[model samples]
Target: MLKGEKLGAAIEAARIKKGISKAEMARHFGVKPPSVQGWVKYGRISKDMLPRVIRYFANEVGADHWGIEPGDPYAPDNLVQLRPKLSAAEGMVVIDRLSVQAGMGAGKLAEHFPDVIDNLRVSKDWLRRNATFTSMKNLGLVTGLGDSMEPTFSDGDALLVDRGVRDVKVDAVYVLSLNDELYIKRVQRRPDGAWLMISDNPSYEPYVIENGDRDHFQVEGRVVFAWNGRKL
Candidate 1:
């Protein structure tokens, strides 16, 4: 929801809070230092780069700092609110479908924070029977692209993500951002605190994030379910 100067201010606040230098930010975005300075000074960024900028800064700080309510779009205000109320009578729960696409192969840019492109309604009983979660507050739907996860979930699958699971609590499939690209991959934490990003398809080589370079990796959410054009 932040735009123009407000957005710039939010980015500056996040940069300062995260202790990221402008030069480092420029390197990350592949721009000159002055471009990043202008982003903080004037909030000028192209439409195409807006999503990436938002995602980077939002992740550095928090989505709420940018007025982004990830899974609940109809809240009365931007301030964090309770999870969406389930219509017990109807036995239904509405989950937001986000514009972000989690690539399974070569990776893609993570797009649109808290932007609901659509909504998927499912029976509350179904969710209880199928998904495992402590709360339903951060449940969302994101499209998966590429064939790296084939046999598990094909390309163009609709993945049910739990945004609340922001860390590698267990070895599982997660939507993560690595080196500025978004991907859906199985992640395992090594004993040494490094992370192993594995593709389900053996054809693709696994990637490792060394313990010392953890700054380039971030777990955005856990993949709880995949609607692969079939049964949920």
Candidate 2:
């Protein structure tokens, strides 16, 4: 069976056992229906989605609810306990998200080497943090969302974003927004007071910001460091 199929079986079994419809399951997990379906049938979901699934199942039927002790051969690791990791095959610049069995192995890596990996990613920018923003100053976590900055800022990379710095240099990488949608891009200001969004990955398209749209976009902060690996 494909990996997604294994994930699908596990999801199907859990939903049936818990009396949750696929739609309810999607809502409970805060994900799209197709994504949930993909998990059960495709055995895969994005890195950000794995934790949610784990929490749902674990809350409903796993260790906290079922009293299944760890290390028991019969103990089942539910989807709610799954952690996500990234994998990038050679020649593929884009990183693929991999769902792992939390507190266990991630696919073949789990079967071969346990406790050695938490997560994985291909971009070095995963370490960029916002050095100076109110909450970020204290939390030091980067708020990464969206896909325009593909190959650099993934849809779900948990950044150790510093919030201490606010100044953005022209043509530098900064997290900003337009129309309430967040974007990560290099800023190139024109003499006419316009900005251009440049993506590092050729796989993505670049955009030019109109003067009228400038007010809609505000610099959240600059990236300093990020973490690209899986969560333990």
Clashes of each: 0, 37
Error of 1 at 148 (Å): 0.7
Task: State the TM-score for model 1.
Answer: 0.61
lDDT per residue (tens digit) for residues 1-232 in model 1: 5767887898899889768799988877778998888888878877666556654543244456666665544223322122232222477776766778879998898663435545567888888888876567689889999999878989889999998997888898999987768999999899999999999899999999898878778889998888864332
Off by over 4 Å in 1: 1-89, 112-114, 229-232
lDDT of 2 by residue, 157-217 (tens): 6554333445455456665644544455667887887787777667656678888987767
Please estimate how well model 2 matches the true structure, expressed as its whole-model Cα lDDT: 0.48
lDDT of 1 at 79: 24
